[model samples]
Target: MSLTADPPSGAVPATGGTLTHNLVNSGAEKVVFKVRSSNNNEYRVKPVFGFVEPSGTTSLEITRLAGPAKEDKIVVQFAPSPADAPSASSAFNAVQPTGNVTIPISAT
Candidate 1:
C-alpha cells in the first residue's frame, strides 16, 4: 500500500513534460486506485485506468501543459481500496480511505 512518483522531487518544467508515477500494493489483497489531475487546464492524464492486484504494481503517465505564468501546484490524487474492501471495484463503492500526492510545475 505504497505509492511513488518518478522525478520524486516533484519538479516539472513549466513548458510541460511527461510525469511518471508508480504504485505498489504491499498488502495481501487486491487493490484499485484512480488518478486525476487537480487542474485539467494545466495537465492531462493519459489512459486513466485503475486496477492493481495484490503484490502488483502499476504506473501512470501525466502530460503537463504550459500555462499559468507562475509556479502551479497540481495534485495527482490516488484513491485505493480499503483493507476490508472486497475488491478494487468495491473500494469505490465504499468511498473511504484514500491518499494523494502533489506535483510542482514551474512555468519557466
Candidate 2:
C-alpha cells in the first residue's frame, strides 16, 4: 500500500502562479494524506489534509502568493487510516507514515 503523485516532474512552476497534483492511494485500505509546503508563508495549499479510500484520487491544489522563489518543496505524507478514523488531524496523530513523496518547485 502506497501513495503516488502525478506530474512525475514534480514541477511547481512559480511563474504559473498555481498548480494541481493528484494524490492516488493504491492501497487496499483507506489512507490519509497530509500535504505540506516548505514555505507555508509563500504558498497556500488547499485541503492541506485529507483522506483517500483505496484506489481513490485526491487533488492537491497549490497557489503561490507573490513571493520570490527559494528552495521550496511540497511534501506528501501518508499513513493507513483506522476503520473509524475520526478526522484528518487525529488520524495523522495516531499512525506513523509509511513514506513520503516530495515535489520540487521551480520558477520558469
Candidate 3:
C-alpha cells in the first residue's frame, strides 16, 4: 500500500507536511510502512502505520514537526508482513486510500 500528496504551497506554513490514508489487509499479516524522503528540508515528520483491528481498517499518519521545514518531497512504502497483515483496519482502510487527505500537523 502507498499514499502521497502534493499539498499546495503554504498548506502547512508553521509545520512541514501531512499524510492520511486507509489500508486494507487482504493477506493474513500486518502491514508495515517504510517512509523515505529526498531533499527534505529537515522537517520532522511523524508517521503512524497500523490497522484498526477487528474492523480490518488500516491507516497511516504523517505529522509535521516544528523547526526548519525541509524542502524535500516525501515517499512512503507499505509491505504486509506475515505476522501482521491480516486486518485491514489494523493498519488502514481505503474508502480510497491513495489520494490527498487533510493536513493534520503543524510546526511549532
Which candidate number would show the highest TM-score if scored against the true structure? Answer: 2
Clashes of each: 3, 0, 36
Residues 60-98, candidate 2, lDDT per residue (tens digit)? 888887666466789988889877777987888788988
Q: Per-residue lDDT of 1-108 in model 1, one digit per residue for the tens?
A: 555444543556777887776666666655556565656787776545466667777776777778755565545445555667655555655665366556565555
Error of 1 at 55 (Å): 1.8
Cα distance off (Å), candidate 2, residue 67: 1.1
**Sort by lDDT, top down from the best:** 2, 1, 3
- Candidate 3 achieves a global lDDT of 0.42
lDDT (C-alpha, whole model) for all candidates: 0.61, 0.79, 0.42
Pairs with steric clashes in candidate 1: 1-26, 14-106, 14-107
TM value for model 2: 0.87
The residue-level lDDT of candidate 1 at 63 comes to: 75
| lDDT digits (tens) for residues 1-108 of candidate 3 | 323233412234444455554544444434454445443454444454433223254544544555564344445445443454455344443322442223333333
